[model samples]
Target: MVIPILMEGKSKYLSSLLVIILLAASSLAVHAQEKPRIFVSTDIGGTDPDDFQSMIHLLMYADRFKIEGLVSTSFQTGRKQNILDMIDLYEKDLPKLKKHSKGFPDPASLRNICKQGAIAWAPYKGFRKSTEGSEWLISCAKKSVTQPLWVLVWGGIEDVAQALHDAPEIKKNIRVYWVGGPNKKWGVNAYDYIAENHPDLWMIECNASYRGWFMESESPKDITAEAYYPNYIKGRGEMGKDFIHYYKGHIKMGDTPSLAYLMHGDPEDPQGQSWGGSFTPITRSSKTIFNRNSTVADTVATYGVIEWRFNGPKINVPSDSTVFTLSIGGQHWPGYYISEGTYAVRYSPKQIEVGEYVTISSITELNGQKGTYVSKAPWPGKPEPNDFKLEQHWYGDKPDQELFLGQQQGAKTVSKHRKAFLMDWAKRWEWLE
Candidate 1:
C-alpha cells in the first residue's frame, strides 16, 4: 500500500512537470513562428526589371517571413504571372532550399497567395477602384494578429492607396516601406493622399538609398555585373540564373532592400541597420508628413532623455485661452506652457515610452499649428540638457544638401550592410547550406 501511494504521487508530479515543459515549448514555438507578417506589391514584368531581381532574393529567403500576399501592382501589368513564374522555379528548387533550413512554405501555398492587382491606374489618380490586390491586403492587415502587416511597395503603391481608400481603418493594421524616389514619381498622387491623410501610419521613404541596392553607396560591389553576379549568382541554379536573366545576365535587385530590412531580426526598429539600409524620419514639410526621409539630415535616428524646445514668432493671441501640447491618436504630452513664443516639450508622464508618436500642437481657438514628433528610445537618467537640440545623421562623406534627400549618393552611402548580405546570399545559392 505504501509503494502504491508513492508511485501515484510521483506519477502526478511527473505529469505536471511534463505539462509545464510542453507549455513552455509551445510558447517558444509561437514566438519562433512570429516572423514579420509581410505583403509584397510589385510591378514586376513591367517598366523596370528590378522587381524580378528582388523577387529572387525574396523567394530565396521566403522561409524567414510570414508572406501573406504577393500582389501584382500597376505598371505594364501581367505582374501576377511573373510572380507565378518565379514560384514555379522555386518549386523545382524547393527541396534544396528546405534542406538549407526548414519553413519554406510549399510552392503551391505561395501560388495560392499570389493575386492580381490593378493593371493600370485610373488615369492620373491615386486609387479609383479596388482589385483583388487591395482586398487581400485588407484581409491580411485585419487578421486578428498581434503584429502589424508589413506592406512592401516595390513598385507603384496603387494597391495600398486603394486599400486605404476602401478601408481607412486598416491603416492601423499596416506599416509601409516604400522604395519611393522613382516609384514616388510614378504614384505622386497616391503618395500625396496617403501622406496627407494617414499621418499616423509608420512609414519609411527609401528614395534615398533604395537605389543603393544596385547602384552606388554603402556597398556597390555586391551587385556589380562583372565582379559579383557573374561569379556568385549567375551559374548557381535555376533561381540564380533567373536573377541574372531578369536584367540581361546582370543584377537589378534594388527592391530587395525593403524585404531585406524585414529579415534583419528587429523589424520594429527601422532606425537600426538591417537587410534594408538605414533610414530617418521625414522632416516637417508641407509635402511629406507620414514618411521618413532617407537622407542623414532629414532623419531622427536616436537620442537620450531630453526636452524639445520650439520657438516661433510670437503672434497676437489670447494669453490664458491657449493650450500647447503634443497630440497624437488621442495621446498628448502634458505640455508645460512656457510662454507665448517658446514652448519646451518633454516626455509625458515622466518617462517617454519608445516608439511613441505624438504631434506638437499649439492651439488657441482662432489660430493653430501642429507637427509630428517621435520620442527617442529610453535612456539611463542623465543630467538633463538645457534644451533639446535637433541633430542630423551624417552618411559617411556625403554633402549637406545631398545628405538629407539621400537620393543617389545617399542610397549608395548606406550599402555596406546589404553588400555583406548579398555576398552570403550568393554563397548560399552555391552551397544551399
Candidate 2:
C-alpha cells in the first residue's frame, strides 16, 4: 500500500508553482503559433496593371498575416497614390470583410504603415541610395521579437537589398521572396550585385511560375469578361468588384502567390510545395540557376530561348570538350556557347506549343564533368511566336522597365493548379456564398 501524499506546507506551494509554469508554457506555445509577421514592398502603378489586383487580393486577407510595413517602390509608377487609392477602397470594405473574420485591421492602421521607397528607378549599382521604405524595412525586421519577417517584394527588391546592406544583423530576422522575370530585366544589375554580395541570404526568386494565376482556358467560354467578371465575381464584394473593375474581371493576381504561400501555413518551408509552388536548391555553377531556383519561371510560356551566363574565376574546361543542350516540353534543342566575360549558352526550341506544360533546361558537359539545369517560363517571357527580342535591358546602363508585351499564343498551361487558388479566394467573399 502506498502512503497518500497530502498537500501540506511546501507541497501545496510546489504544486501551485508547477501548475502556473504549465499555464505559462501553454500561452507561449499559442503565441508561437500566431500568424507570421510580414512586410510588403510593391511596385504598383507600373507598366502592368496587375499589381493593383494583387493589392486588392492582399487587403482582403489583411488579418491572415501581420502586415508590419507597406512600402511603395517602383521603377515607373514611383508614387504612393496607387497604394492609397486601393486603401481608400479597402477602408470602405474593411467592415464587410471584418464581419466574416475579426482579423482585419482598421483602415487607418494600415494607412499608417504605408510609406514610399526610392522614387528614382534603380541605378546600375546596388543600394545606390536609401529611402523611407528601406529604412522602415530595416527597422521593422529588427524590431520583431517573435518570428522571422517575410519580405514580399512584389516589384523591385532594391529596398530589401538596401535594408540588408545597411544592417547585416537583420539577416537572422528576415526572408525575401521576389517576383522576377520581366522585372528581373529591369533589376538585373541590382539582382546581380546582391547575389554576388549576399550569396547566403535567404531569398526566393519567383519568375515565370507566377503565371499560374491566369490559368489555361479549357473552353472559349471560360476566363471571358462576362463569364468571369459579371457572372462569377461582379457581386461578391467591394474587393471582388475592385479586382475585376480595372482588371476587366480576370484572375491575374500573379503576385498573390507570395502571400498565398504564407496563407497556407508554415511560411518557412519552400520545398514541400503549397499554393505558391515548390522549389529546388541550386549551385553557382548552375547555368539555369536563376530559373531552376524559381518554381514558376518555366510554367507560363511553352516556347522561348533561355540564356544562361556563368561568371567564375576561371573555368578550366577545354572549348572543344564543352557541350550544351536544352531539354523541355517533350523536345530537346541543342544550345550554342559563347564566352566573352562570362560563359553564355542559348537554347531555342524546335517544337513547342502554348497552353501546355513546358520546362526549359540547359545541360552542359565541361571537360568530362556534367551538370543539368532546368526551369519553367511564362507567356510574357516568350518573344513573338517566331521572333526574338534583344536581351539588352538586362545588363545595360538603364533599367529596362517595359512589360513583355509579347503576343499571346491563345493557349494556357494545363498543368498549373490555378483552380485551387481560385477556390480558396472565393470562400473569403460573402457574395460567393
As for model 2, its CA RMSD to the true structure in angstroms is 12.3
- Residue 427 displacement in candidate 2 (angstroms): 2.3
| 1-433: candidate 1 lDDT, tens digit per residue | 9999999999999999999999999998988678778999998888788788788878888888889999998567556999999998888778888777897888888999999997864322346689999999998998998788999988877888889989999977888888765565456546555654565566766654665666543446546655676667756767776666666766667788888877664666666666677655532212212222112122222222223445554656543222455453564443333456654443322222233344445445212334444432111112232222222321111223443223243453346665677776876777542
Judge candidate 1 against the unseen true structure and give its global Cα lDDT, from 0 to 1: 0.63
User: On a 0 to 1 TM-score scale, where does candidate 1 land against the true structure?
Assistant: 0.65
In candidate 2, what residue range of length 10 has the lowest lDDT sum?
A: 391-400
Which of the numbered candidates is closest to the native, going by highest TM-score? Answer: 2
What lDDT does each candidate get? 0.63, 0.59
Q: Which portions of model 2 miss their true places by more than 4 Å?
A: 1-25, 217-226, 285-417, 431-433
